[model samples]
Target: MERTTDPVDETPLTAEEYEAVHAAVAAAAGSRSRSLNSLFADWKDVVEDVEEGYSLCAPEFDDDLACRDALGRAWPLLPPRVRAIRRPELDELDGRFRAATVPWPGRPEEPHQWWRYRIPLVVEAEAGLPRPGGWPLGWEVLPFPKPAGVRVVEWGRP
Candidate 1:
């Protein structure tokens, strides 16, 4: 189904405007060898709006709703003919977003142990992600043990 937003200022977007945003987003994702997933799927369209000098957003039904909410605020200032693409129905956007942001590493069948340095050198390098401090960067060289979960861990000299 084609979902559209309320008309702004009695003017609708032109085809060229839509195409421009679409192309910009495609270029961004394509350069990274990634396709636009749910959370950022509408990026192409949004980029077009940005190029036209405005912000636009399309709503979603899942976790992407949070991302959309954060990004939507700027829509009103977006350029002419910029329309937002609504979220997809599959709801897999959340998973895709998670995977994209936080990548899983190492073989599941192998023993996993990741230290802060090791994580940044191994998984982060392979994934082309940045080196994050303060934790092991959520890396696991071995399979996560059964009944294992994350909780607050404090560190300081008493």
Candidate 2:
């Protein structure tokens, strides 16, 4: 259901759609064996309005170096124009990494129009610390306990 000029057309998801989303989330959460990449690849189709890809960053680092290192690795995978937002409230001990893809000027028809899909990473921060061999430039070694939680929100024009 695409949104037109009318605000009423952009109403919240129907009960059936919500149910599907809930089911998908539950499935993702339960699949502890899958990696983060695999989880996103599997469920991206189930969730709607996810044009701007999601991200995962290390928030519970001893220093900014670790945080920046994680962000640098995850940045390339994110959709173009996406930027990181520091979320301190999500985890007071380690904070959280949030990346958002903002619509470019004049591209109102893109997915950034009225709604956005959010997928949260359920990471085991302590387990993913830099190894003695050195931290790789990706999340392959990161301990992802389960697939990310998903949600949709109406975030009108920036």
Best by lDDT: 1
Give candidate 2's TM-score: 0.20
Residue-pair clashes per candidate: 9, 0
Q: Runs in model 2 with CA error above 4 Å?
A: 1-9, 31-158
**On a 0 to 1 TM-score scale, where does candidate 1 land against the true structure?**
0.25
lDDT over C-alpha atoms for residue 147 of model 2: 27
> Which lDDT tens digits does candidate 2 get at residues 85-134?
21221122112222322222233533221212122322222333453223
Tell me model 1's lDDT, rounded to 2 decimals: 0.31
Residue 142: error of model 2 in Å?
A: 10
Give the Cα lDDT of each candidate.
Answer: 0.31, 0.30
Per-model TM-score on C-alpha atoms? 0.25, 0.20
Question: Mind giving the per-residue lDDT tens digits that candidate 1 earns over 1-158?
Answer: 23345444245447775555445444433432332243254633332332332211112112223334333433333333343343332224333433222222442322221111011111111223332332222322224421122221222325
